[model samples]
Target: MVATTAPPPVERVAPQPPWAAGLSDVTASDASLRRFLHGLPGVDQVGAEARATMLATRSIKTVAKAWAIDLAITMIDLTTLEGQDTPGKVRALCAKAMRPDPSDPTVPRVAAVCVYPDMVPMAVQTLSGSGVRVASVATAFPSGRASLAVKLADTRDAVTAGADEIDMVIDRGAFLSGRYMQVHEEIVAVREACGNAHLKVILETGELVTYDNARRASWLAMLAGGDFIKTSTGKISPAATLPVTLVMLEAVRDFRDTTGRQVGVKPAGGIRTAKDAIKHLVLVNETAGDDWLDPDWFRIGASSLLNDLLMQRTKMATGRYSGPDYFTLD
Candidate 1:
């Protein structure tokens, strides 16, 4: 009888991270994009708006309120995106991110200091070893009308300058014109250009014209490998409304259900008061579930929201209104 030998055992392949699974298949062609995106469930404006309004009424008093305030501070992307964004301004913002309130060491620091790509190095230098991250906005920013080459170069420069996170704007014109594949390709290219840095794709919801469109854009960005889906650039009006944010939260929730990926959601612009920030937290808690309550999975993109959160936190601690005078403006 001939001796029989068992074949060598096959090596088991490790599973891809939930976020990366099925991405290659979806991005293969324009037909696939249309089939996937158009197949997503549509958003109901009235229902989403009503849900946000109801959540806005959630009341958190005393200890719970204070906890929410601190959490909001940690979720802030302390932003300063003006043409006059000087190195001095960037350093000042970095200082605030490091020490939100010099008077009280108990107060938590902001999440990151967001600045133009040119000022990323200054932010990185100032925030070094302090636990605060440096985030830069690239890809032609608020208006993504530039060529893909220019956008990729802009993103690479920020990454080379040590930006910990890259906030890139999608080509709104392409998305609006039914060019879903073009937008997806751009996001994929930018995600590649970002290398190891986290990528946040801005939908600029204000320009999308409808909740359905915003939902579509949100899904498109996530499918293209965006770590976070941002609502706006804060340069336009009607930025970061409650209803729009609710729609985004819903999209992310469904995405997680479908892909087992917990992508982040950022509602940028127009959220100035602590009350507004808390409302957003409630929306996140109730809608996306508490799994996304942490800073790693949620962010508030604002320049002034930090001060408001500080004032409220002080009020909760000491029985008096701290006012804007207490917190330094960066």
Candidate 2:
């Protein structure tokens, strides 16, 4: 792992917004930050896992299933973040986001298309006026091992390229080392660099190792100005598991109750099939309540989830099981 110096503590130089009411009230001292984070509710691992398992068994049929499929389509952050990503691929992803299914204009488009910083312009150009926003994963995504300056610049570049949202990875090393203040400062800096774009802080929970750490990371990100707290970068194993997501959901639910600020949650990676998608919805409805069921408060970061949803929707409509050839190769 790469070593880098932690940035200085973030001072409340900028005025806090109305939504930042509770978070801004907390002192920036390391001791205070640690006290607040560690003092939050502890996760009952067995209870959480059992709840997730029970929720996954929820059954929906006919119209409700169809509605869920459509809702899932709208919440997708259709993503393609790869070293081999090109302009053509971005444009294709944009196209898929816009229409999703060519034969069905009635299908609602996805929430946004997620890509790397360099591809932001191509995505912006292609998605312009389509009502589909462009989201870029920045701040040395997946690893987030770069210096603070590099990470902020990476975020700024994507915003300058017209990205509507920024998904940034937190330095797991800092979090694991108990540098709560440092991790908080990094998120605040990236949130500032984002300008008007929404900031989705990627906790990369797979690397965090424990439910307690994931809960702590979720609160840390939200308190530091994350509009959304995402589970993974979709680049690691054990990404976006039901139990892990349940922990994040509980965190958001508790945060909203105390802060009146509703931060979104995105469970990226390992989510496929209509059944899996609907189960997530069930989890959302049951845990976070109906308010979080909207796309504004929840998202699924996936590359192939849209195709599966399309196939299921087609199946529901035509009463026929359509093969993979039916949908676009996004």
Candidate 3:
């Protein structure tokens, strides 16, 4: 084991980790960063898929299932990102975020309400006193095919609008073409642009096409000072899956072990069912242990998943499941 050094308290600074001890110069240049990222242990594709599949099958029923349901509820990033989004829609989403199931006071608020930069102010305003955070997807979200200037401006606008969190997509074009340093620099710049808001770096793993690339991207994001590394933008097919999330959970677990800076993991996109959310919680608990189980270290990005969680929560509390009509759609 390389003798790793300690990082300054993350509360005070955006920690740009020095790789690990002897590998301090890993991010010094393009070539070193590439070599270090590529040199890290390769993933066993079959084993990873099999392990994730096996873990997903583990069941949590009744009382234990209820606990997982609430935990998953609190981890949601209730999102509404669309070209047709209106201020009223954002306001409604914010209301749902603050009090997901209005009938159930025991139900916990979600982690945030994710929207476009233009909608941040409305979300922030509605969620002002509520513990629910306002997260705006910036840096040309869904498709990060914009210039650094544009991306930085997008991040700045969201933060200025009182967004508590910023979700930025990495340039898949740069990353796929072997420009690792460019991706790292962009995340660092966005993190700086985020000011005090937490930065979630979206990897868009579907484009990467492999588990090894996902692991590399996770490390790259953490090194570049992202508070959280996300799985996808939720606009594409094959959005957050168990195996992909398992690999990311492993990356964060290993990262904290080496750098002593605990970055978070979020699996966004396509996870709409309560069962899917619970599977992810099982994966986190079994792989990353209980620490990543909180809302701070883990997040599930979805708009419709909240309603399903509410339905399940109602079923657990009452003898029968609540009708889908009982919950307001997001």
Candidate 4:
């Protein structure tokens, strides 16, 4: 029975890169570190609603200023309903809303206007003179369930339509099924399709159903060359929780530590009130530090949120409350 052929030499998989190793550590230890991580203290825990109200009122003067500044820097990404956002409508809205008045220097322009692929050209043309970017949701947005060819074509078309940023949704179904490689490859392919446009991979954490999954998705997206990792699609309920944001920001921080590459984070959906916005800002500051607090690294995707923020700011600057229609929206 003698001469069994020698087994072919085994191929060794390369060791994890430093960045990968660091991310692994961050995700691995997140559970234990949960209590220490930054988050909002419970208002209910203050013994009574009346006491909480008193405490909240005392902080209003200080918090109002911070809220105003943060609001001014917010990027309202409007992934509007198809027919609701006609080219003429988008153009008029951009023209009126994005113009910076010298007298209102405190009101910073929004970072970008995010829209669907069909509306990208309109946004690009409308936002051309203004410094605001035209972002398109591509790669089967809200649910990235499509053939690779279809997804790639979608991404290519969005970039061709003058999208400065491509917000592509990841294959959550694959990721949830434990098909991490498939998810990673898809992100890489879409990122490649983006060309010069920045790639913002939407994890849609609401569907991930677990904080661990969100962190893993965040790491995988960043590893596969995502310029930013965003939260929800705004179509889902229970969107953009503080714990989820904490986990994603930690992923960004860890990825930066490992690879020296900085990635942005966006928390979208259901983030309407000014207090909620400030809490997000506080989370970003405490977790990702001051550097990530800028519009480049952070954004809040909201339609109603901006108006509330503008109202709060108007109240602070002029010491009086403004009506719901303070900032016109066409």
Candidate 5:
């Protein structure tokens, strides 16, 4: 067989890294990107899980638990991405997001309502004037299987529809195959498509196969100007577990320290109850500090999590569990 040759390198300029007075872009080329990502510290998987478990098990005082329940409500990206989702369903979800508990007006609205790109107009119309943002998943969500032009069009359409945020998935195939520049440029291009909207870069960590890849993907997303480095697309198994989130929390915490720009961390999928949400809040506080505890700096992407949070909030106030009839179906 004839000798094979690698593809020619693409010339790209990554968004400038957050820097102090005397620094410059460190990941301007493919070789430097590989060096930079590879050079970052590796994760201790067993230790990370052990610590995540230990932190998850920590108990909060009754008073603090009540506070956490509400905070989690405020951070939820109330989502509905089913194939059969209709305009009426999107409107209903928006209504739930704005009020959460119809009888108890004290319950705060969610941070945003996450939906597919096609449903953005309905979401925007329904959530208008309410503080809840409309977040659309783009870049061939769940699979990240599409061309750059398609992904850019996906992002722009959502933004034009008045989506306040765009959740974009990175090309995990390129990432896993070690084509770092390909993945980086896609994120940069999508970030531009987002325009005034915030960009949440979904790593879909379950496909990444290792904690090291998750950590590297986090740094890569942050360096590429992702306003948030999210853990998953909420479409795969093992989505948003505590251990995976712990590694991401550490990555964001350290990234902020190095660059002085704090990027958010969101763990989507598989988080379905009040207890699980609280555990993540504790993890964020203990691992990333209280600075990340706010809705502005952190978000939980889920479909059923809001109902549980409302139920728990009611239980806290009434000292009894609210039956299934108390809340609408997710």
Candidate 6:
């Protein structure tokens, strides 16, 4: 019988980077974040309780009015649509809503005007006195396929053109391929390129393919210094789902728990109806609490959602259905 050679000892792969390992530590100590989230009674569990405990019951009209006010107060970030090309039009549209009615303190200002990097200057110039921020989708947006130099240049150019926020798409391919370090490094470099502007790292959840990956990406982005972790670019087929949002919120909660850093979350794409918006609001209320409800920590990236909300509000107030054209393009 031939003697069998002894198998060579297997080499052990090293643990993940410091940032990745530290995610758990950071997420554990954020008691305030946990307290706020846990304290908010979930509508699913306490809807009846809420209805019974209200100081006074609200009529349908009152509920409609309240929804109108909520819609008006909502921070809507309009991502681009295929037919809408000019930044001027986007600016005009945002400007009309920027002028908050002094008579109605209930009406909150529009959040910000988001656009392609080339249009940042136009949006910034148009929204100069309007108090609306100019957000640019940079760093090989919707497809983090470019070289590091190109991504940095893209981010720097957007900032130089007056972008208040840079929404960068992470390298999903690398992340999926088990190259977490590559993803982490890319996000850090882009964050550095952002300068003082806020960085929204898009994980494109639909493409991530699993809740575990979504959670991992969320932690990775936060650890890599992302100011916000956004879901979807709205360019893909399957965009923003409730389950995905749940995973992300958990990640945010966990991140804050450990690092004491407050990271924002934005759910973009396929969020069209008022009921859908309310569901997201409910999620925020339950998962992240009152603190994250504001535009500072949360936002809805939509194109036609505002118009539908506005139309519904007008109908509820006037008791008549308004035509689609009721909302002017500008």
**Alpha-carbon shift of residue 109 in model 6 (angstroms):** 2.5
Report every candidate's CA lDDT: 0.88, 0.88, 0.89, 0.72, 0.88, 0.71
lDDT of 6 by residue, 27-133 (tens): 33335223323333332324333432331232223564455336534667766744456866766656645743333444566788788888878788888877778
Every model's TM-score: 0.92, 0.92, 0.93, 0.79, 0.92, 0.78
Model 5 ranges off by over 4 Å: 1-23
For 1-330, candidate 3 gives per-residue lDDT tens digits of 001221222332324444445456788999999988988788899999999999888777877788888899999999999999999999999888888888889999999899999998889889998999998999988899889999999999999999999999999889989999999999989999998999999999999999999999999999999999999998888999999999999899878877778999999999999999999998887777677889999999998899899998888888796888998965
Q: Model 4, residue 120: what's the lDDT?
A: 85
What does candidate 2 score in Cα RMSD to the true structure? 9.2
For candidate 4, list the clashing residue pairs, or say none: none
Q: What's the lDDT for candidate 1?
A: 0.88
lDDT-best of 1 and 4: 1
Q: Candidate 3's error at 325, in angstroms?
A: 1.2
lDDT of 1 at 125: 93
Per-residue lDDT of 290 in model 6: 50
Number of the predicted model whose TM-score against the real structure is largest: 3
Residue 330 C-alpha lDDT in model 4: 39
Pick by TM-score: 3 or 4, better one: 3
lDDT of 5 by residue, 197-278 (tens): 9999999999998999999999899989999999998889879999999999988887776677899999999999999999
Q: Once model 3 is optimally superposed onto the true structure by TM-score, how far is the C-alpha of residue 13 displaced, in angstroms?
A: 26
- Provide the lDDT at 139 for model 6: 86
43 in model 2: Cα distance from truth in Å?
0.7
**Which pairs clash (backbone N, Cα, C closer than 3 Å) in model 6?**
26-257, 26-258, 26-259, 27-257, 27-258, 28-257, 28-258, 30-257
Clashes of 4: 0
Candidate 2 lDDT (Cα, whole model)?
0.88
Q: On a 0 to 100 scale, what is the lDDT of residue 81 in model 5?
A: 86
